[model samples]
Target: MPVTKLYIDKEVEDYSNVREFSSRIDLEGEIVDDQQVIFDIIQESSDPIQKAKEVIFLTRNKGAFIKKCPGTSIYTCCGYKILHIGTFCDMDCSYCILQTYFHPPIMQYFVNHIDMMTELDRIFEEKAIHRVGTGEFTDSLIWEKWTDIASKLVTKFSKQNNSILELKSKTVNIKKLENLNHNGKTILAWSMNTPHVIKEEEKDTTPLKARLRAAQKVESWGYKLAFHFDPMVFYDNCHEEYKDVVRQIFKNVSPENVAYISIGSFRFMPDLKQIIQKRFKESTLVYGEFIHGLDNKMRYFKPLRLKMYQAIVSEIKLLAPDVLVYFCMEDDEIWEKTFGFVPDKDEGLSKMLDKRVAKLCGLNKGLLI
Candidate 1:
């Protein structure tokens, strides 16, 4: 969390919560006249992308807090809901879409918790099974040093019976969560990768062993867990390394405590390639065997991706076969070839995940439980 500069929204300067959030930080603060200051800072930066992580923005989310995941119809979608808490991350990953998804990616912390609570209250009243998460746009736990955002969301979801909150991050920030009355309504998840990948590609993230140790602590605290082997890169000796990662997972926590596991191959938009090329020229990920997908992103060749996934899925099944395993934004051909059937055919992927949530966390009456 190298927040060298802080930009406070003028409108939120008087709010006590915002004031409290900014009080303990050591960085110098500037009272911005308006949100345009964001664009100005980006335009003025000598290196906008790098400078983006060097600064933090304390602002309000004027838009709706809740949004549907922008899943493509060309694939079998999971239908997960995104709680737009904030955008951008403090950590740097060579394969991160944040570098290209948002121009001049900035670490934004929405100070308006009331707006978030208001939206969540409405969703809880709807009483429909919903799989909601705060990790879509940012590392959900990155703002823990200044804000109790993770604690607040956990407490709120504890009393709800229809929706479960998934806080996914590469960092180990689970201290605030252990004391909260989450009532198994929260899924404490970690993004897993090989030690080689973590050391080479993921910058400033917790080490793999430390992340698993944190998961062990959270599991002991009685929170249901989840893991994502996403952006599963097809690098040198990746198969054995990933298999070892799966073994490490079961070594730390029981399979029954897991809510689900998600696996996704590395896929990114075309423009992101240039950003990686310019920003991380030494990265070999950009030079891998890739083909343009229906969604216009460059993905690994089908057979190659399947080989990598098959190796990983086989390892995971050996350790935790009963744990629900799914892909992130892949098509029917990939799913059918990998699992012998598409999850979309029996019941929608979203429904299956929701049922997992309901069964594991007691969100509602689900057969899986």
Candidate 2:
């Protein structure tokens, strides 16, 4: 979606990143003091949540830039670290948690590079392998249109030897990354869904074919690739559609080049249903055969989720037996039933991903980069 307006924080008016972004992002709307102020302003509006989507708030964050993901122990967590660059997304997916996550759901970008890098310095000093990603709070590359965030992050991670940066997105903003020297330390990932889901649910995102093509472009540029069939929407005859997506992925890029592929069925918090229903009146993707799961969120019936996961996992294994395939936010029981084993036998989810990083990107305990 085109940013119709810009909300600049007064504190960072002279900041270089702010100046750079202000020059590109359309500055055509009412300015607010900051993100919270913007939320307050929108609250009195006719539709605060909807209006919030039109404005982009630029501010300097006053917290730790890097933090551990809030993965619950109820499920086998991925143990991935989250780089909290920003919150909310530009895309209008039907099942977005941000719809109810924030009162107004403003698209906020924290422009404090010095502090962010300072925290990362500590992580880099640790000898342990840390797998970090920027997609936890927002679409990783949404800042591509307004700032040099992706290129800067890639460049920063390039010099690091232990941790690999995963930049996941639903957009095709690979222009800035195509020529960068990433040192094979950055995984260019995309959250993909079936073409039908893309068309009906993932509003304003790059089409499935376009996203795959973008991934192919980055793969040719020597960057490791990853994919997530996350929130894999369940619909009529989803088996063939998902299978087609899996095949097309390998067709566009080699399996050897793919670092990992994560498969997850559609799951959401109970509070999210009304927001999705209100925001996307035509969408029924959230109204599936859902039951309350261990995490207190509504999930597809275990047997149903197992069926879909089993089918997709089977197809992926048949095509690329050696590739690392895993589930996102799923429990050990689901893993055992579907894959015939859990990740516990092989260290854990975090170490497994680290091993994938070491094997695919050539990082190891002996050699850093």
Best by lDDT: 1
lDDT of 2: 0.85
Error of 1 at 231 (Å): 0.4
Which structure among the candidates has the greatest TM-score?
1
Please, what is the TM-score per model? 0.97, 0.95
User: Where in model 2 is the C-alpha error above 4 Å?
Assistant: 28-36, 345-347, 367-369
lDDT string for model 2 (148-254, tens) is 88898899989888889999999998899988989988999999899999989999999999999999999899999999999887888998889889999989999
lDDT of 1 by residue, 256-284 (tens): 99999999999999988888888887788
